[model samples]
Target: MVWPIDLAVLTLVVMVAIGSLMVKDLLGAAILFGAYSFMMCLLWTVMGAVDVAFTEASVGAGVSTVFFVGAVFRTSRRTRD
Candidate 1:
């Protein structure tokens, strides 16, 4: 099936990925990464890959994002510009 939504989600994923890498702030990067993961989940869902989408939602957006945020907060070292 031709999916216009997949293209949109892909575009959003790319933009979020680029923004995540470009940001200097650790917290912002983490949030952007989470957004990227969510977009990936959406893309997979659109592509009819429910298993992959669910995994991405749980591991990428959920556990990974939470881990990053928690680690950033727990760490004493500050991110350099």
Candidate 2:
């Protein structure tokens, strides 16, 4: 690789990851998780791994997030503990 991933984008990814973990609402968590996946895709692209980026975009950012949101909508958002 000629260059490295930008620090700013990496920081944003970390923030989104933390936000996804910290959110109480399942829907909000799903959104943040999608954002995290997108950021990862971006980082992968920046690293010149187009195939990995595409796979992450389609699977992590697209299909998985949709599935998570759908499941979240079907279930109660509140925790049982």
Candidate 3:
């Protein structure tokens, strides 16, 4: 794997992780988490772990993101007194 590309993807992964945590909106955080998962899949692909990469892409980025967004939509934006 080329060091520069790997470093870039790794940097993106870290940035996305932090961004997801820092996001105030649940939907935005879920999108960031999906991006993070996609970056992780790319990192795994660069490392020659194709199976793991596929799993991350499918389960982490795909299914989990859908679930998170759905859950976020279902939740009411209300603060209980």
The residue pairs that clash in candidate 3, if any, are: none
> For each candidate, what TM-score against the reference?
0.88, 0.87, 0.88
Worst 10 residues of 3 by lDDT: 72-81
The reply for model 3, stretches above 4 Å from the true place, is: 77-81
Q: Candidate 1 at 67: error in angstroms?
A: 0.6
At residue 30, candidate 1 shows an lDDT of: 91
The 10-residue segment of model 2 with minimum total lDDT is 1-10
lDDT of 2 by residue, 6-78 (tens): 6677888999999898888888899999999999999888888999999999999999999999999899676
Model 2 ranges off by over 4 Å: 1-5
Model 1, TM vs. native: 0.88
lDDT score for candidate 2 against the true structure: 0.88
Sequence-dependent TM-score of model 3: 0.88
Kindly list the per-residue Cα lDDT of model 1 for residues 1-81, writing each as its tens digit. 347887778888889999998888889889999999999988888888999999999999999999999998897325665
